[model samples]
Target: MIQITRTIAIDEGELDESFVRSAGPGGQNVNKLSTAVQLRFDVRNSPSLPEGVRSRLERLAGRRLTRDGVIVILAQRFRTQERNREDARERLIALIREAAVPQAPRVVTRTPFSEKRKRRDEKARRSKTKSLRTGPIHHD
Candidate 1:
């Protein structure tokens, strides 16, 4: 079982991993060994995640999530397949943990009186400076 958090754990069977040839500084190993790990998690079909977490995960996944609601994480940073696989799993857990936490709602606030006054004073100063740069008004 893959534990995302204390409350959330997904069975190993749920995660699908595919190996593909990696392109990098692996020399001949890059061509021969499929080191890259493609981790696919079906967010829409997962019984482990809560509805809110699934929705947030979908949004966070962005281009990584397919139309079928599968989140694909490509792990190619490591040369070894095992390391890459571990990296991908860690990333998946981290992403889900992030989704699990509810985001604090932002509260709208009005500008303070002192702040408004300061802004007005700055604008007045700028206008006065610009007026000084211009030639004095002449009465014909």
Candidate 2:
């Protein structure tokens, strides 16, 4: 079981890991070993996540989310499968943890009349300054 957060924990079986050839630095071993780890997690089907978290996760995934609501994370920064696997899992956990947090709704705010007046005053001041400079560059 993987503990994503204090309130959310995922079963170990929920994660799907596949190994593929890494294009990252590995010298000659890059050609022979599959060090890259591709981690897939089904966001739509997972029972571990709350509905709110699932929706947020799908949106947060961006290009990583597939058409079927699967998030594919590729970890190839490391040259070893173990490290790549750990990296992939860590990224997945981080993503899930982020989704678990509820986003505060934005509050609509209006500019105060005084603040607006101040801004207008600054704009008028700058405009007058520029207009004064345009009268003449050469004076006897």
Candidate 3:
């Protein structure tokens, strides 16, 4: 079980890991060994997450989430499979933890009366200055 928060724990069986050959630093070993870890978690089908958290997780996952709602995390920063696996797990936990936190409601604020007045005054002043740039009107 992976504990995401005091209330949220995900079963280890829920995570699916696949290994692939990584593209850097290992030289000849890179060609032979599969060091990259691709971690997939089904956000839509998970029983561990609350509805709100699941929605937020899907939104946060963005491009990482597949059409069927599986989140794929690729961890290839490390050259070893163990380190990459750990990195992938850590990233999943971090993402879930972030989704668990409730977002503060945005407070809609109106423009202050003084600020509105100042803007109107500035516009009037600009209009007056531009008006003065024109030559005097002549009547035929």
lDDT of each candidate versus the true structure: 0.93, 0.96, 0.96
- How close is every model to the real structure, measured as TM-score? 0.90, 0.86, 0.93
Pick the winner on lDDT between candidates 2 and 3: 3
Q: Which structure is stronger by TM-score: 2 or 3? A: 3
Residue 79 local lDDT, model 2: 87
Candidate 1 RMSD to the real structure: 1.5
lDDT of 2 by residue, 1-140 (tens): 89889989999898999999999989999999999999999999999999999999999999999999999999999989999999999999999999999999999999999999999999999999999887557868
Root-mean-square deviation per candidate: 1.5, 3.3, 1.4
lDDT of 1: 0.93
Top of the candidates by lDDT: 3
Residue range 1-140, candidate 1, lDDT tens digits: 87788899999999999999898558899999999999999999999999999999999989999999999999999999999999999999999999999889999999999999999999999999998998888999
Clashing pairs in 1: none
| Sort order, TM-score high to low | 3, 1, 2
Quantify how close model 2 is to the true structure by its C-alpha RMSD in Å. Answer: 3.3
Report clashes for each candidate as comma-separated counts.
0, 0, 0
User: What's the lDDT for residue 53 in model 1?
Assistant: 92
